[model samples]
Target chain A: MDIVIVVADAVRASVGPLGAAYALTAIGLNLHYGYTGLLNFGHVAFLMVGAYGTAVTVDQGGPFWLGILVGVIAAILLGLLFGLPTLRLRVDYLAIVTIAGGEVLRTVIRSGDKDSLTGGVFGITQFATTFFGANPFPEGEYGWGRLAFTERQLWVAVVAWSLVALATILLVLLVRSPWGRVLRSIREDEDAARSLGKNVFAYKLQSLVTGGVIAAFAGMIIAIERQSVHPDTYLPAGTFLAYAVLILGGTASRLGPVLGAVVYWFLFEFTDGFLRGAISAGWIPGASSRRPTSARSE
Target chain B: MPADAVFAAEAVTGSRKPDAILVVNGMHRSFGGLAAVDVGHLEVQRGVITALIGPNGAGKTTLFNLLTGFDRPDGGSSTFDGRPVTGLPPHRIARAGMIRTFQLTKALAKMSVLDNMMLAAPHQRGERIVYAPLRSAWRHQERDVEERAGSLLEKFGLADLRDDYAATLSGGQRKLLEMARVLMAEPKMVLLDEPMAGVNPALVESLLHHVRELRDEGLTVLFVEHDMDVVMGISDWVVCMGEGRVISEGRRRSWPPTKR
Candidate 1:
C-alpha cells in the first residue's frame, strides 16, 4: 500500500467538508463555552436534531432545502427548550441538562417504535441525493487513486469550507461590536453587565440559540457529506472531538475552532492510518484489524 | 440634625419639600428576617455631592441598590424626575439617567480598558443585533462613542492604557475606570457604592476631585463612603445611617466637627 495515498486521503478529509462540519460545530461550542461561559455539554444534540429534522422531513416529501431549513429551526427550538428555564439557573446546571439531553436524543432516535420514521438502528438515507445533485462540480475523480473522491465530494467540500469561512467572519464582526462586547462582559460577570444596562438573561438566551442553530448546520453538512444519517452519527464521542477542537484552538480566539478541527482531524486520521499500517507490517504482534487469522495464511 | 428636623417640619407633612432629584418615602427591604433597608424619608438634592456615611451593615449599599433598581423594596415609593421608579429593571433605571458603580469595582477583566468604557455608551445602535451587520448605520456613532471614551479616559489619566486588558490595571486604576465608565451614559444622577474602597491615598484625593467635578458639571451624586475626610471635604450634605435607619441628616460641618 502506498503510504502517500493514505496521507493524502487523511489530508483531503481533514480540510474538506468533513473537517468544516466539525469546525462549524466548534464555532457554536466556542460561543457557548468560550464567549458566554456557558457549560453546554450536549452540544451535539443540536446536530442530531438537525440531521433527523432534515432526513425525516425529506423522507416525508419535503424539498431538500426545506429539510435543511427545518433542521435549523429544530435546533433553534431545542436551544430554547433547554435554555429558557436552564439559563436562568447556574451555568453547571446547563451542563448537566445538555449532556443528559444529548444521550436522551440519541436513544430516542434509536427506539424501535420510531423505526418507520427514524429508520431506527439502520438510520436514514436517500435524503441527500437532492443535495449532491446540486453539487455543481463536473463528474470526475479528484486527488490520488484510493485517496480520491468524486467531483460531488469536491462540491460538498467547497460548500462546507465556504460556510465555515462565512460563519467565522460573522462571529468576528459580532464579538467586536457592542452587542458582542456585552456577551463577553456577561461571561466576565453577569451582575456587572446588568448594572451597565444589558439584559443579561435575554443575551444569554440569544447566544444559546445562535450557537445551537449553528451546530445544526454542522449536522446538515455532515449528513450531506456521508449521504446518510445514522443515530450513532451524532454520538457523544463526536461532541468530545468537537471539544478537543475547541480546546486545541484556544478559547475565545475567533479562528481557533476551525483551525483546531483541521489540525485535529489530520493528526487523528493520520495516527489511525499509521497504526493500521504498522499492524499489517507485523510491527505490532497482538494488534488486530478484525480479519480473524485466515486459515490459508498460517 | 435639629435644624434639619425643624426645617423638615416646616416644609410639608412629616418631610421636606421635593426639590431634590431623588426622593424616597418609607422604602424598606429585608433579607429573610433581617431588615436591610428601612429609610423612612430621604432626599438627595440635585447638583451636589451628597455623602451617605454609614458603618458596615448600616444599609447604605441596600438603599443604593433599591434606588437604582438593582433590588426591589418591599414597601415604599421613590421617584426620579417626578416619575415613579420603584420597580423598574436596572437597565430601565440606567436609561432614565441614574448610573452606578459597584463597591468592588466591576471592571470587565478580559476586555480592553477602552472597551470597558465604550461598552457603557448609551443608546448604541450597534448593540441591536439586527442592525449590527450594517456597518454604516453605527460606524459614525461608534466613532463618536470612542471619542467620548477617549476624552473620559484622558481626564482620568488612563488614556495610555486604553488598549490594555482591564484585568491588568491596579485596584485603584480599576476604581478610576469604573468612575469614568459611568459617565458614558451621561446620567443625570450617579450613585457610587464605595468608589474608593481600595484606592490609594493620592488616588483618593483625585477621586474626590472628580466627585467635585461631577457636582460642578451639575450631576447629582450620592456616594456611600466611610472616609470621613473625603466626605466632609467634598459633600455639601451628609446623611448618616445606622442599623437600616437614618440616624442623622445634616450639613458636613454641624455633626460635632472632626470626629477624626
Candidate 2:
C-alpha cells in the first residue's frame, strides 16, 4: 500500500462523520464518569436506545424531528430506569447493572420476536432520507483528495460537530458554576457532599439522565451518518472505546473527549491501513496473506 | 459570652443545664447482632463545646452517625433545634443546620481547596442545572460565595493553597480544610468524628482554638475523640460512652468526678 493512501485514510477518519460520532459519545461519558464519577460501564445502552428509538419511529411512519425527540426522551427514561434503584446502593452495582442492561437491550433488539418493531438482526435503513434532504450543502464534494466528503457525509459531519460544540459549551458553562462544584465534590466523596447538604442521589440521577441524553444524540448521529441502524453496532466494545477516548483526551475537561476522539480515529485508521498493507505484502510470517479489501473496493 | 455565663452558672450549681440543641432519646443502632449505639438519652446544649469520649467500638462514632442522619437508629428518635429530625436524610439534616465531618476527613481531594469550601455553601441558585449554564443567573452569588470561601480558607491557614488540589494537602491540613469547609454553610451545629485523630501537637493546639472559637461564635460542637487531653481541654460538657450507652456526663470542671 502507498504511504499517501495510509495518510489520507487517517486524515479522513480523524475529521469525518465517524470521529464526530465518537467525540459525542465520549463527551457524554465524560459527563458521567469524568465529572460525576458514576461507574457507568453500559454507556452504549444509551446509544442503543437512541438509535433504536429513531429507527423504530421512522419505520412506523414518523417524521425525523419526532424521531430525534423520541430518541432523547427514551435515553432519559433509560437513564432513570438504570439509576433509580442502583445509584442509591453503590457505584459498582451501577456498573454491573448498566453493562448487563446494555447487553440485554442488544439481545432483545436482535431477537427474532422483536422483528416487527426493531427489524431484528437485519437492522433498519433508508429511514434517514429526511435527514439528508435537510442538508443545506449543494450537491458536490467537500474537502480535498481522499479527505473529501460527498454532500451527505458533509451534512452529517457538519451537524454532528455543531452538536458537539454546543455540548462542549454547555459543559464549560455548567462545570464552572456552583452546580459543577457540587458534582466535583460528589465525585470526590458522596458522604462529604451529603454532609454539606447536597442531595447526592439527586445529583447522580441528574448526571445520568443528562449524560444519557447526550449519548442518545450521539447514537442518533451515528445512525444518520451511516443511514442505518443495527443492533450489533451498539456493542460493549463501543462503550469501552469511548472510555479510551475519554481517558486519552483527559477526563473532566470539556474538550478532552473531542480531541481524544479525533486522535483516536486517526491512529485507529492509520494502524489498520498500515497493518493490512503489510499483511497483504506478507511482511508477517504465518499470517494469512489476504487481499487489500479497501483497494479492491475503491 | 452567654456560654461563658452558662458555664459559670453550671459550675456553681452543678445542675443548671442550658437548652439542648440536639436531643436523642433511646437511640439505638445495631449491626447484625452487635448493638453499636444504644444511648438511652443524650443532650448537647446550644452554643457550647461538647465532647463524646469512649474506647474503641464504644459507639461514639456510631452515635454521631445516628444523630447526624448518616446512620439510622434501629429504635429511637432525635430532635435538633426543637424539630424532630428522625430518619431524615443526611442532606436534610445538614440543611437544618447540622453538619458533620468524617473520621477519615473527606476533603474532596481532586478539587481545589477553594472549590471544596465553596461547595459547602448552601442554597446557591447555580446548583440547579437549569441555572448552571447561564453565568448571569448565578455569577453575583458565586462571587459572594468565593469571597466567603476565601476568608474561611484564610482562617484555616489554607489561603496560599486555594488553587491547589485538596489531595495535595497534608493530613492535618485536610482536617483543617474539612473543618473550614463545613463552616461555609454557617451550620448551627457541627458533628466532628475524630477531628484530632492524627494531628501534630502544634496543629492540635490550633484546632482546639478553632473549636473553642466555634463555640464562642454561637455554634454547638459535638466531637468524638479518644484523646483525653482534647476532651478535658476544650469540652464544656463531656459524655462518656461504654457498651453503646452514655455511662457518665458532667461539667468539664468536675469531669473526673473527684474519684467516686
Candidate 3:
C-alpha cells in the first residue's frame, strides 16, 4: 500500500466518529474526576449500557428516539447503582464499585443466559439505520482531501459535533454558576460544602448521573455510527483511553476534553497505521505487527 | 487602643442568659473511651458573641463538630432557634439558618474568591441542572449574589482579590474569606472554629471587630478559641471549657471562675 494513502486513511478516520465518541466520554470523566472528585473507574459501564439499551430497544422494533431515551435512562440508573452506597462513605468505595460494575456488565452481556434480549456473544446489529435515516445533512461528501467523509459519515459527524458543542456549553455554564461553585467546594472539602448548607451527597449523585448520561450518549452515537453493538465493545481498555483523552485535555478547563480528544485520536490513528505499515513492509518482522484496535472494529 | 485590648463588662450566670438562641440539655458525645462533649446544660445568648475557650485536647473542636452536625454524638439533644437540631445533618442545620467556618479555613482552594462566596447562598434557581443552561433563568439572581458577595468581600478587605484563586490567599486572607463567605448564607447563627488561628497580627483587630459586628447585626456568634485576648476582647459571655466540660460561664471581669 502507498504510505500516503495509509496516512490519509488514518487522518480521515481520526476526526470522524471515533474522536467524537472519545470526546463525549472524556467530558463525562472530567465532571466525575475534575469537578466532583468521584473516583469512577468503570466509566465504560455507562457506554456498555447505552449501547445495549439502545441496541436491544431498536432490535425489538422500538422507535429510534425511544431507544435513545432508554439508553440515557439506563445510564442514569447505572450511575445511581454505582454511586448511592459509595458516595456517602468514602472515595475508595466508589473506585471499587465502579470497576466491579463495569466488569459485571460486560460479563452479563456476553453470557449465554441472556442471549435472547442482549443477543449474547454475537451482539446486536442494524440498530443504526433508523438513526441515520433521520439525518438531514444533504447528499454530499464533507471534509477536505485526506480527511474527506461520505454523506453518511458526514451526517453522524454533524450530530456528534453538535452534541459536543451542547455538552461543552452546558458545562461552561454549570461550572461558573452557583451550582458549579458548590461542586468545586465539595471537591475541595466535603465537610466545608456541607457546613455551607450544600448537600454534598446529593450534589455528588447529580454529577455522577450527569456524567454517566453523557457517556451513555457517546455509547449510543458510536453504536449507531458503527451500526452494531458487541459485548466486547466496552472493554476496560476503553475507560483508560477516555482517561488518556481527559489528561491530554487539562482537567477543569473548558473545551479540554474536546481538544484533547482531537489531538489524541490523530496521534493514535497515525501511530497505529505507521506501525502496521512498517510491519507489512517487513521492517519490524521480529516483533508482533498486530494492533489491538482492529479487534474493536471487528 | 487596639481592638484586642477592648474588654466587655457584661455578666451572665450558668445556663441563664437574657436571650438564649441555642440551648443544649443533657448533650453527650464520646470518641471510643474518651468523652468529647458532656455538657448537662448550656444556653447561648442570642445576638451576642459567645466564645468557647479551652486549651488543647479540651474537646473544644469536638464540641463544635458535634453541635454543627459534623459528627454524630453518642447522646445529645440541642435546640437552635427553638427547633430541635440534634442529630440533623450539617447541611440541614445550615439550611435551618445556622452556618459554620472550619478551623483550617476550607476556602475552596481552586475556585475564585467570588465563587467561594456565592457557594454559600441557598435556594438559587440557577443551581438546578436544567435551569443552569438558561442564562435568563438565573442571571438576575447570579448578579444579586455576586453583588452581595462583593460587598462581604469588601467588608473583609478582600474585594481586590475577587477574581483571584482562593488557594493563593494567605492564611489570614483565607480565614477572612471563609468568614466573609458564611455571611452570604444570611445565617441566623454562625459557628466559628478557631477563627483566630493562623491569622496575622495586623488582621486580628479587624476579625475581632467583625465578630462584635455580628452580634450588633442581630446574628448569634459562638466561636471556639484558645487566644485569651480574643475571648476577652469580644466575647459578651465566655464559656470556659476543660477536658470535655464547661469549667465556667462568665463575663470578662467576672472570669477566673470560683466554681472550678
Candidate 4:
C-alpha cells in the first residue's frame, strides 16, 4: 500500500465538495442545537426537500436559479410545518417529529406513487447542465495525480466552499449580537427568557426556519456536485453524520462544523483507501473489495 | 378566624385601592378539582414592599403565578397600573412592566452572568432576527445595554463574575443575580417568589437591602416569604393566605396580631 496515496485521498475528501456540503448541513444543526437548544433530529429532511425541490423545478422546465429559490422556499415551509405545532410544546417533541418527518419524506419521494414527478427509487439525474455550463473552470485537470480535481469538480468545490464561508460568517456575526444573546438565554431556560419579556415561541420558530434554510442550501450543493438528487441519499444516517460532525467540531462555535467535517471525511476516506489498498495487495485474509458490493446488492 | 372576619378585615385594608399598582378581584384557579388559589380580592399598593405569607399548599405561589400570567385563573380579572392585564401571556405581562423571579431561581445557568443580565433589557432591536446580522444597526443600543448591565452587576456585587456562567455562582449569588437580572427590564412592578428561600444567612441581608432599595427607588415589590423576621424587617404590608384564601392582611406594624 502506498501511504502517500492514502493521505492524498484523505486530503481530497476533506477539502472536496462533499465536505463542503457536510459543513453547511452541520452549520445549520449548530444554529438549531448549539445556539437555540432545539433538538432537530431529522435535519436531512431539509436537505431532501432542497435537493428535490431544485431537481423537480428544473425537470419541469424552470431555470436553475428558480429551482434554487423553490428549494429554499420548500425548506422554509417544511420548517414551519414541523415547527409550528411542536416548538411551543417541548424540545423533545421537535426531535420526535423531525426524525419521523425525515423518514416519511424519503419514503414518499421514493414510493411508486411519486415516480412520475420524483423518479421514484431510481431518483433524478443529469439535471446539472445549467450549473456546470456556468462553471468558470477551464477544461483540464486541476492538480497533482490522484490528488487532482477535474474542471467540473473544481467548480463545484469552489462554489460549495464559498457557500460554507458565507454561512459561517453570517453565523459568527449573528451569534455575537444581542439576538444571539437572547437565543443562548432561551437555550439555557425558556421560562426565564419569557419572564424577561422575550417571545420564546417566535424566536424558536425563527431559529428553525433559519437553520432549515441553510440545510436546504447544503442539499442544493450536494445535488449540484453529484449532478443528481437521489432519495436514498437523504436518509436518517445523513442527519446522524451531520450531528457527528457538529459534535466532533464542538457546538456553539462558528467554523467548528467546517473543521469537524474536514476531519471526519479525512478519517473516513483514509480508512476506505487503506482498506481497499490492503485488499488489492492481498494483505488481509478472506477480505475482498468485491465482497462488500455483493452484500450491499443483496 | 372565620371567613367573614377575614373578608371584613380585607375590605378595610382594601380601601387604599386608588393608588394600588396591582388589583385582583375574584381570582380563582384549580388543578384537577383541587382549588389552588381562590382570592376574593387583593390589592398591592404602589412603591411599597409587600409580602405574601402562607404555609405549604396555602396557594401563595399559585397566586403569584396567576398574577404574573404564568398560570391562568379560572375566573377573575386583574389590573396592573390601572390597565386590564387579565389573561395576558407571561411575556406580554413582562413587557407591560411586571417581571418575576422563580422560586427555584432561573438564572440561565449555561449563560454568562453578564449575558443573563443583558438578555433581560427590553426593546433590544438586535433581538429581531432580521437585524441580528447587522452590527451597525443595534451596536449603539447594545453598548448602552451593556453599560446598564455592568452597573447592575456592580450593584449586586457580581461585576467580577460577569463573564462567568451563571452555573458557577453559588445559591446566594444566583438569588442576587436573578434579582439584578429582573431589574434590567426596568420593571414597574416586581414579583419575587421565595427570593430568600434558599439564600445563605449572610446573603439574606444583602437581598433584603436590595428589596428595600427597589421600593425606595419607587418600584412596587410583591414577595412571598415564610420567615416572619425577614417579612417584618422589610415588608410595609403583609397578606396572609391559608387554604387558597387571603386569611388576613394588615399594615406592617399591626401584623402578626398578638394574643391577649
In angstroms and one decimal each, the interface RMSD of every candidate reads 1.2, 0.7, 1.2, 0.7
Model 1, span B165-217: residue lDDT tens: 99999999999999999987789999999988879998999988898898878
| Candidate 3 lDDT for residue A279 | 78
- Candidates 2 and 4: which is better by DockQ? 2
Q: Write candidate 4's Cα lDDT for B1-260 as tens digits.
A: 11112222333434454367899999999999999998888888787778999899999999888988889999999999889999998999999999999999999888889999999999999999899999999999999999999999999999999999899999999999999999999999999999999888999999999999998798989999998889999987788888898877776776664321
Model 4 CA lDDT for position A139? 98
Poorly placed runs, candidate 1 (over 4 Å): A1-6, A112-116, A289-298, B1-14, B256-260
Candidate 3 structure quality by residue, lDDT tens digits, A147-203: 689888888877888888889887888887777877888888898899988889999
What's the candidate order when arranged by decreasing DockQ? 2, 4, 3, 1
For model 2, the DockQ equals 0.89
Candidate 2 C-alpha lDDT tens digits along A1-298: 7889888989897898879888999988998999999999999999989988998899899998899999999999999999999999879999999999999989988885445688888889889989888889999988888878999888888898999998888888878888888888888889999999999999999999999998998999888887788888987988999999999999998789999999999888898888888888778888777754552121
Tell how far residue B22 is off in model 3, in angstroms: 0.7
Ranking by TM-score: 2, 4, 3, 1
Pick the winner on TM-score between candidates 1 and 2: 2
Off by over 4 Å in 2: A113-115, A292-298, B4-16, B258-260
lDDT of 4: 0.89
Task: Write model 4 residue lDDT over A1-298, tens digit each, in one string.
Answer: 8989999989998999989999999999999999999999999999999999999999888998999999999999999999998998889999999999889989988885445799898788878799999989889999999899999999999999999999999999989988898889889999999999999999999999999999999999989888888888887988999999999999998889999999999988888878888888888888864734411121
Query: Which model scores highest in DockQ?
Result: 2
